[model samples]
Target chain A: MKINLALAQINTKLGDVEANLAKHLEYIEKAKAEKTDLLVFPELSLTGYVLQDLVASVAHKPVEDDPVFKHILAASRDLDLVVGFVDEDSRHRFYIASAYLSGGKLVHVHHKVYLPTYGLFDEGRFFAWGDAVRAFDTRFGRVGMLICEDFWHASPPYLLWLDGADIMLFSSASPGRGLNDKEKLESARWVERVTKAYASMFTSFVVHSNRVGYEDGLHFWGGATAFDPNGEELAHGPYNEEAITYTQLDLNQLRRTRARLPLLRDERTALVQKELDRILNRG
Target chain B: MADINLTLNTDLARDILSGFIKSEITRVGLSRAVIGLSGGLDSALSCALAVAALGRENVLAVRMPYKASSKDSLDHAQLLIDQLDIPNKTIEITDMVEPLFQLDPDISNMRKGNIMARERMIVLYDQSEVFKGLVVGTSNKTEILLGYSTLYGDSASAMNPIGDLYKTQVRQLSRAMNIPAPIIDKPPSADLWADQTDEKELGFTYEEADKLLYLLVDQRYSPQEAVEAGFNKKFVDTVTTRIRRNQFKRMQPPIAKVSNRTIGYDFLYLRDWGT
Candidate 1:
């Protein structure tokens, strides 16, 4: 099966959901016109990153009645959307979350499990941590969504893979920092390395969408990319600018890659779990 | 101490800084920038980058010269104005600061210099309103770390584009921006007094200071670690102390916390909040 995906690398207005929703609608129309099956946005595409006190003000519930999600759900009937927002639960706990919407209905929501609080980041002080990582079946295939920092940890993506996710959608509002020897931002280089490694190791399609533009002092380098099951880059957006990057992924490549090197079919879950239990109980 | 790498990808740095100026100024509901052109490398580089971000038409270069300010300073600033062809104004700050100096007859050079700097800021801010622009700052990292600027004087600005770049990096970027060769090659000076230069005032060259500071701050090396890395022990100690002492110049005034969410303590929000 072939699925067309578009990475909408957007610059969100800080704490203004109305403006961001309008931009999302415009991007959705552009994606639909291009016949894309799935459209992905960077983390907090609806609410800007670097939001400290504005977190509570911008938090939304991904329901049919939400002001932001209402327009998103209406636009999702023709295409699938993986959108990022601040999610407020029934208990008033806020989380950095991304929701998967298909056929004008909410499919799955993944709250970011890891909140970075060191060196210019303060997410841990603001939002509640997500406690679960699970894969859900989409119309095209079984897929998983991981926000930035969640995929930085190995266990979240590994859990999704073991739970039978063939496609991993990663999104981030990563600010550009640390110029490298190759004139590339170090954060971008490290993220691309890990995404490519994940795709090759798990033999699954890895798609990444990082935001662009500046917020306060932070500059988000927009270089969205996708890697096929063979660990080759299929598409790459421009650096330091906003653009939509589209790529078509063939599910047959997964079968071919796994047939040659069956990393996923090694059947070692029981041994891994036993070792993990032993390691945890050592104290 | 080991030599630290102070090299930057000038192309990437230029683009990043330029984009920062544009995004920040426009985000604050202003499309134009008002920069005080001191005819020095730092201000020249800042003006060029502002022109790169906001077109020359959108950037206003204001030259505020006191009575003791060098002729070369004004001439070099004029040269940059001609090169970029941006709108510019020359407001002599002698009259603005003379009254304050007259009130205190025995004022030291430091007080007079500070008064001049603050007077220049008043002119720049006044022009910022007239031009409908934000005040773009030109202070580089090396001096800021050493606390070489007057508090609320040269350090004050609506936004700074080159504050993160050290003095050495500023010269490199200025050269890249094609600022006048004389401006980049000239000995660095605050030009507060007739004979004042930054290196002479700071007791060291910016080159050595930049390398030492890169280790101490960027590399997170302690004073002992920095001395071991080859920086002089006295230099390390003095530089570290200056950074600590000038901490007030780098931050907003501390507010006493009484409420649950006091500003800057628990009432955390970015400057870009709600914009």
Candidate 2:
């Protein structure tokens, strides 16, 4: 049950949704050539991040309604693709979402939960938060999907773990600043450590992909990484560089690790929920 | 429309300041103006121009502080006021801001920082009413081009004197005016949060960012040309993208085109519209 995963770190042009989609298609072809079981792309890969008001004009409807998405779906008939795009709901609110495509069918969509409104980021001004934590059943395994800032929170992944997801994929378009080198490294290390810990606890493989190159004032530092079920770093990409990182994961090895670890089986959900409720209520 | 140009020298700076202040005053029809004295170089130079145009008594300096603001910022602000001998007042906004934060604890530190900035503006505008003066802005061209100031916060001003000068040019002008060297050399900051610096948040030194910006925007260099000119491609792209992305912040709200001569919709006027 070994599967290969490919993370595409592509530089995207801002506001050029068509060009970006073309770039994504090219990368997908490259990933397919490399015999990738799952191909992951960075957040907002279709239109680029920080488009400001342009997101309102350029954001597409669901996959069925969007012609570009239809093309992507048609091209993805033979590949398992995880790509980010702008999704506009019926209420006209846009969302930063990643679509999972398998066998030319839309499998699942994960909306980015955390809309960063801090310095140089105004995602909140343009996007609405997602409400569901979904783990779709795939041929490789039970795959859990989360967008950037979604994995930043502990609750969503923890919930997906409880839903019996055997593998996790996270995508991001995190920007880089020169003075924030230490902060960036610390955040990357934190993501790695937390995902690895989650993987070991749930006996799952975790794959994370981020964009590279500069968009506006923010530089997307591409540091895509992965961890096996035993919480070991399998592969990592270079920071501030575009790359396609590949890793092979064995589900049989994950099962063996789960059996040996036995951490998930001894879980206490009711108590955890109660404690979480208490904390949320306190705030 | 002959592409107005001036030499980057002390005499030219003084002449430009004099003309700019008079034009702005005449355009707004306000005899007095109020400025938030942060004791930073931008404000010191702005205060000097305000005094030169409206006299020391006609200019009012307001010092607003939060709890975590550095003592040195307050001291320097007071020193500038004393040196200029302008009528000024100090107001602490910590108490006003803290209670609001207590009501909504989920507000992030970043949002809280923005709230502090807006609070300071609220005081400035309020004092503008009290003193019957216009709120003078101190933001330089570098910050304005980069969209570094908070919109409707620090960016909200009746009129700005140094909005067209780069940060390096501001320093040069400050030296010509004989303003304190400490103010000019100090790390530029908004003093929004404790130990927060602008260059730290922007990720590059002001000198580098400003020079790079001048090359790309003013000198009309393409991204490739800027990179070939010894600037990092990533840095150039970042600055250019920021300027493009934040262009909306620098203009009036987008309007629906209904009238033939609407203010921002159809009838386009230069910045010195009334003047």
Candidate 3:
């Protein structure tokens, strides 16, 4: 199947949820016009990153009775929308999350697991770590969602691939500065390389979306990208520029790539699991 | 090894350092200054500038080493003293700091680190009292930006000559001074913990981080612009987050406003005290 994917790169303000939602709705309309089968957005695209303490107050809880998300559910009735936001659980701990919407209902939500704590990041200070990886059944295919820093590691994407996700989508709010354009592009290239190598290794497609804007002394570099099931670059957006780009990915090519490279067929998961156990134990 | 640039050359740095010392000394009306010499680049640079401006006899270099401090650091610090031939003394602080740790065994590594820093500062300040001198600081601009130094510990000083220079720039000045090659080439550390390195804790090299910081904080590059300029987005985000998160460390403690112009309240005045 040939699937149309859209990457929305837009500017966002810190703690401005309503304005950011309005922007997301506008972008959704644009993506709808392009007739995209899937639409992806950057991390924290709703309330922006570096909102500090405001995350507790502004984070949205996915309630069946909540009107804001109800409106999103209504608007996304016809299209597949993947957007980033903050989710508040019952424990009151906030999570960096990506919501998947399809056919006017909430399909699945994935919480960010890797909370960066060192220099220039206090994610550990503000948000709690998520425990599970979620995949959803979609009209295009079985899709998986990951937040920023999730796709940086190879394990999450590999797990999603194993869980029967034919397409993997990443939403990120990657900061930009000093030769960061090349760095971001190179990083994207690395992600593409890994996804393609892994996609060919696993027979899947990978799509990534990033944001653009300056918030609290940091700038988000928007360079949304997509790789085919064969791990080739199907499309890429400009770094630091707000844009929406689309590409068509054919599912048939995934089978061809998988057939050509049958690495997954002859894999050793037990040994890999043992190695993972060793790494985690060492940590 | 990266080629270090101060951005401000030796002559310019000398002028800036001298001017900062002269103005601060005049403002405080102090003829003598005391420094806690760690044998590290930051302290060495600060002590050198202080000696040049106030004369060797007026500047006191106090080396306060604990149990964990490397002998190389002491030897290098002695080399700086002997080379400059400044008035100096070595005070073993292990006896003083060990008791506090014994009293509270649950004291965190962070707390222990702070105690080590504060112990040294206590010695420096006590010496200041004996010598009638002001405590000169060794913190650099990068440390201040990241809030890496301990407040009232390494962060507390009357004035810092090298506070405006980044770590990369400090290395440049160190090289220009022909200060021993070992001191210039050695990795930066507080020596609070054995085999500890600053960059390892910070998650990026000073050269990479300082360049990112200069563009983000100084040049006002947006995160997107920074990424476009070839910096890693994750690294950029990390550096920018640190700068924002540590903003509190850059300012005086917050106080409830009662007066029209309290010290850190409405009374916020320009730091150009002497000028």
Q: Number of the top candidate by TM-score?
A: 1
TM-score of chain B of 3: 0.92
Q: Native-contact recovery for every candidate?
A: 0.69, 0.00, 0.00
Question: Comparing 1 and 2 by TM-score, which wins?
Answer: 1
A1-283 in candidate 3: lDDT tens per residue?
7888889998775676777888888988888888887788888888777766667766896555665577677667868888788999988879999898888888898999998887677788778999998677888778898887887787888889777788988888876422221323334556556656755556678878888755533446677888876767888887666899889888898778778877667678889899989998995
- Per-residue CA lDDT of candidate 3, range B151-213, in tens? 789998887777767888888877777677778889998888888889988878888888877
* Every model's DockQ: 0.70, 0.02, 0.02
- Candidate 1: residue B181 lDDT (0-100): 93
Candidate 2 vs 3: which has more TM-score: 3
Per-residue error (Å), model 1, residue A66: 1.7
Tens digits of per-residue lDDT for model 1 on B211-241? Answer: 9888888879889988888888888888999
Lowest summed lDDT across 10 adjacent residues in model 3 chain B is found at B266-275
Ranking according to lDDT, highest score first: 1, 2, 3
What's model 3's TM-score?
Answer: 0.54
Cα distance off (Å), candidate 2, residue B83:
45
lDDT of 2 by residue, A1-283 (tens): 8898899988776667788788888888888889998899988888777766567766875465587888788777878898888888889888999998988888888888778887656778768988889788988878898887788788888888889888899888876432211334445667667877877767788888898765423446688998888988899987766789998887888768878888788889989999989999996
**If you score just chain A, what TM-score does every candidate get?**
0.99, 0.93, 0.91
Interface RMSD of 3: 13.8
| Alpha-carbon TM-score of each model against the true structure | 0.98, 0.53, 0.54
Task: Show how many residue pairs clash in every candidate, following the order shown.
Answer: 3, 2, 23
